[model samples]
Target: MSNLNKLDFTALEVSGRNYLKWVQDVKLHLTAKNLRPAIEEATDKPVGEAEKATAMIFIRRHIHDALQTEYLAEEDPRALWVALADRFDHQKDIFLPEARHDWQHLRFQDFKSVNEYNSEVCRIRSLLKFCNETLTEEDLLEKTYSTFSASNIVLQQQYRAQKFTKFSDLISVLLLAEKQNQLLMKNHQARPTGATDYDDGTRAMTGGSRNAFVELPACVIMVGIWVKDMTDGRKLDVMSLVSEDQHED
Candidate 1:
């Protein structure tokens, strides 16, 4: 009875297959203890006193409020189990379509991380499986790609080009790609403009060019304002000023 208390049971309600699964779990536990006869219809022989007591204990502990009032008066555990099944089994039909819609439309949102997104996908997959509608590996892969962030262009492209038989492999690649993206973003933010390495392995700006720009701290902003004033007041083209400056240099 102490061990039975530890066994998890989903509360029974008007809707969902969770109650059916919970009942099945309880039945298995009873079967393992050689006490299944307590909850099963008695044959030619009468049920033992111990079996009846065990079954009653189980029902009293696990039965939900929605079902308690109706089944509480019943002395036979097997009859009570059957009554609950007859009333709630039809709920699978109602839950199936809803689960299908939810699984089909499930997408990774910006606020969720990769693991969080994967957990939701797995959760919906489980619901679909319970409804006898399991998605194929290819279908799951496609759905995963479809829901992935549009910003993950490189990862998306790599996924398309690669040949991955297992969804786990794809997830591994995606996690690695996400980490690499984070690292690139961090490096980009930390690096100073003109300090970034060029294709030739040299800094973007030479030492002299860097010094010239640094010396004229407000030059770029001042030039932009001057150009706007000249353009509005004197009808001067911005390109002419640029060409004049280039020639002077």
Candidate 2:
């Protein structure tokens, strides 16, 4: 790729199928490059000619060849931005309803992981935002709370009891719990099975008991925090620890 093509985001296509995302990417990059004023209607201070020229070049580089040729006569970054918006801004009209449908059906329990759920929610939220629909923190929280799978009633109740006011706080807590649970699982897998601890800190394999498994009761809390039976949503207690002991002939 040419050095110009080595940009953070790909050039906007002529079809404008990805117009919404492309606009967002361009705005973010422009802000980062301190060229935002080049396209803005008003600025705290006058945007220098050199800055406007740089912004014009940047905007041109991130557009399709057809678009470049279409607006070759446009020298002003602000004018180019307005032209692009006017040409492809109709994408929101086509995407808003679809975004709403996805948002209405979004379920936290439907996803296998928190990260996936978070990503989907953010994507839909961005689309809604583009359509002038605001998704509040309360909306995010309610959507998450209401979508807990039937098997996770107890877990859902536990999270509700905490009364998380912000989506960020709730997601942060869930991510931490998941990380801790994964670490505990890694430690458990690394430990040898059928090895019991003695009073003097010695470990020995039980005789003729290959199926015997030791429970780290202290660490089970990590499992209880995140993992729940999809069958019953039952909070498995320390006393109800699951054993994966292997059987040997």
Candidate 3:
């Protein structure tokens, strides 16, 4: 008996937009059970009773109602799979233009972390590939570099000086830089104020001379702007601001 428990097709149904990926998942599960040939092969050759039964059960249990009504009546799992693919696969055609628009306009915002920004780039790339559009590594690298926030000047300069054949390597280096910058910022935040005892046994208070302007994190600044905009320029309480930042994070 095949371990059908290992595959849960319910999670694979993510609407028409993800139909291709869902079909791929179904095929992989079928292959694992030694039943893929029943649906994938063009031969009219009969499969074992067990294989045929298993395929039918899997398909009926997993497919969405919209797909099942149209395809399941065929009673042949292979035909049903093909019919579903033919119907829902046109989603890429419908979505390609919107995806392209998003890619062209996408940029790293001050409020987003390096990881978050990188993930969005990867997502756009995947969507484009699903629509039968391919972007080379060079294209990806250029897109990633061009989308960085204006605050990331040091990183932009460092990356520009080096050549990376792969986007992953560039992401790794950027993530490391981001981590180091975060540590430095934390240290700066924790540094002591300027009050010290001199050798003449006099205490000197240099608080007045110390810089009072503390640079806020980009995310915090963005949150403040958002709150102000949403409330029509009304200021929020400190706790409310803190809560909003927590939610955003």
Candidate 4:
């Protein structure tokens, strides 16, 4: 009843959880209308109706994908945009309400039996947890892939390839390399005061400072020239003196 913004985040973690619960409640209410049809399609003994269960699976995937995209970017717009666009086949509007509606209307009609329905429900329940919803961690683990995201997998690769003198340096490197580069750009302002101390110290010790990863992407050729200057004695020789003077006369 009181203003939620007035509450301290450290002491009052309930608001965030409540808000997500509210959203999920609304989504479930809207989607429940379609569940019977979906179950019917998935459970039907006839092959014609049974094939329709695939549609239900697709719908569930869409719902999960939408929630993950929405929640991931809710705090970081840039990352949200990047994740929604890249992860969902370049679809720019993953958060649209229409998507939620379409998912709600999806139907499945054929499954072998109650066991199959239970099995599918188990899978769906795990996926729902991975999205921003009400589910236990144990429930999530039941899924074949508990945590699935293309960006994360790629970042893992980048993290593996990086070589840093310090652990933080490697983190910075991996942050920039990930396709969801936006994730790194968010919550940056909330970083602890000492988080950058190592980087700053390194820069000062070297007498030069540059965020090589962020900068190189902006002007790669210029970076090459800068590197050349640094490596070649910090000098650029246009022509030396002029062997041309002797030849011109």
Per TM-score, the best of the predicted structures is 2
What TM-score, computed on C-alpha atoms, does each candidate reach? Answer: 0.59, 0.70, 0.67, 0.16
What is the per-residue lDDT of model 1 for residues 84-137, given as tens digits with 9 covering 90 to 100?
Answer: 778777766877888888777777544356777778778777766766788888
lDDT of 3: 0.68
Any runs in candidate 2 off by more than 4 Å, and if so which? Answer: 1-5, 31-34, 42-49, 191-193, 196-249
- Residue-level lDDT tens digits of model 3 in 91-207: 888878987998888876532577987788788888888898987899878877776678877777778779999988888987898899999898667644332223122111212
Prediction-by-prediction clash tally: 0, 1, 0, 14
Error (Å) of candidate 4 at residue 119 is 28
Task: Point out the higher-scoring one by TM-score: 2 or 4.
Answer: 2
Local distance difference test values of all predictions, in order: 0.66, 0.81, 0.68, 0.36
Model 2 TM-score, 2 decimals: 0.70
Write candidate 4's Cα lDDT for 17-101 as tens digits: 2332333343353245443333222344333344234433332233334353445424332233233334443221323333344
lDDT of 1: 0.66
The CA lDDT at 249 in model 2 is 28
Candidate 1's TM-score = 0.59
Candidate number achieving the greatest lDDT relative to the actual structure: 2
Query: Any runs in candidate 4 off by more than 4 Å, and if so which?
Result: 1-20, 23-127, 130-158, 161-174, 178-240, 243-249
